[model samples]
Target: MSKVRGTNTLPEMRVRRALHSMDYRFRLHRPDLPGKPDIVLQKHRVCIFVHGCFWHSHPGCVRATTPESNGEFWAKKLAGNVERDRRSALELAEMGWRVCVIWECETRYTDALVLAVNRCMKHSGPISL
Candidate 1:
């Protein structure tokens, strides 16, 4: 679980690659921002969070499975993760930043991920929710 240590995960790297190929220069894990977004494009005022489908409890995702044992513990733990994510996104938006979440599942397809990133960057408001 501590393998990624909350940075430089596979999905995050993939997203970074796509963004770079698009010619969008950006910073990574800006500590000053809420949740310390995985990728920060301050020039565009956009914050991208690369969330794991399981850890962030991606709704309707098969990867977000619950453990048969310690049901209560896993439930509470995952719930907390989701709540924290929601709060961070809200905070970023209130601070006038456009927040986008690229889930782990989404990163599996390089073409689709690139298109989604491009589309989100063109939008006016937060595309995270």
Candidate 2:
């Protein structure tokens, strides 16, 4: 599925639009950050990751369907993705940066996406989990 994107995803673009409309300035994909978060508000010490439901293995999400073929391969692949996400998030947190993970499903719901971003803008915490 090379056609599948790993950057500039649809949900990521939407989040960027919302943040821009709110006058929240941020860096796109800061390489210095763990996992190279989608949007990085350096001034606020906050980073946001717009994760795909299928790629990040969003729990309880219908979009995260396991392939009927190559069952074991898909399972291991998704599991690794999730594990990597956890590790990178932990690393960012331990380094004193606030992290916000916005899943594709959440972004699909306007209210949820808005709420999460607004909270990120206003939150003074280290991480939103």
Candidate 3:
């Protein structure tokens, strides 16, 4: 568990590089923000979270499978992660920030991920649900 990373992960780096190449400047994990979003575009008021499929319990994701041993513990831990994510996103939305979650599975397709980020940045106002 100690080896696991919470920030500057591969997926996060990929997204950051892609966005930077596109001339989109962003802040990294601003402490004042709810959940301290991984990528914060102050100009666009958009916050992006590059989440691991397993840790965040991505719905229907193959990597989200729980371990056979210590299933109860893993289940609780993952559930808490999901719940915390939901709460943080909601709080950010309430604060008029656009929240975007880029799942680890989606990072495999760089083109699609870049397109999604572009769309999110272009979007104006608070996200609808």
Query: Number of the top candidate by lDDT?
Result: 1
Which lDDT tens digits does candidate 3 get at residues 33-100?
Answer: 88999999999889999999999988999998999999999999999999999999999999999999
* Overall lDDT per candidate, in order of appearance: 0.88, 0.85, 0.87
Backbone clash pairs for candidate 1 read none
Root-mean-square deviation per candidate: 4.1, 4.0, 4.6
The worst-scoring run of ten residues by lDDT in candidate 1 lies at 120-129
Model 1 scores a C-alpha lDDT of 0.88
- TM for every model, in the order presented, reads 0.90, 0.89, 0.90
**Per-residue alpha-carbon lDDT of model 2 for 28-120, expressed as tens digits?**
988878888889989898989998988888888999988999999999999999999999899999999888888888777677777778777
What is the number of residue pairs that collide in model 2? 0
TM-score of 2: 0.89
Pick the winner on TM-score between candidates 1 and 2.
1
Per-residue lDDT over 40-123 for candidate 1, one digit per residue giving the tens place of the 0 to 100 score? 998999999999998999999999998889999999999999999999999999999999999898889866686668666985
> Higher-lDDT candidate among 1 and 3?
1
Segments of candidate 1 deviating more than 4 angstroms? 123-129
lDDT for 125 (candidate 2): 46
Worst 10 residues of 3 by lDDT: 120-129
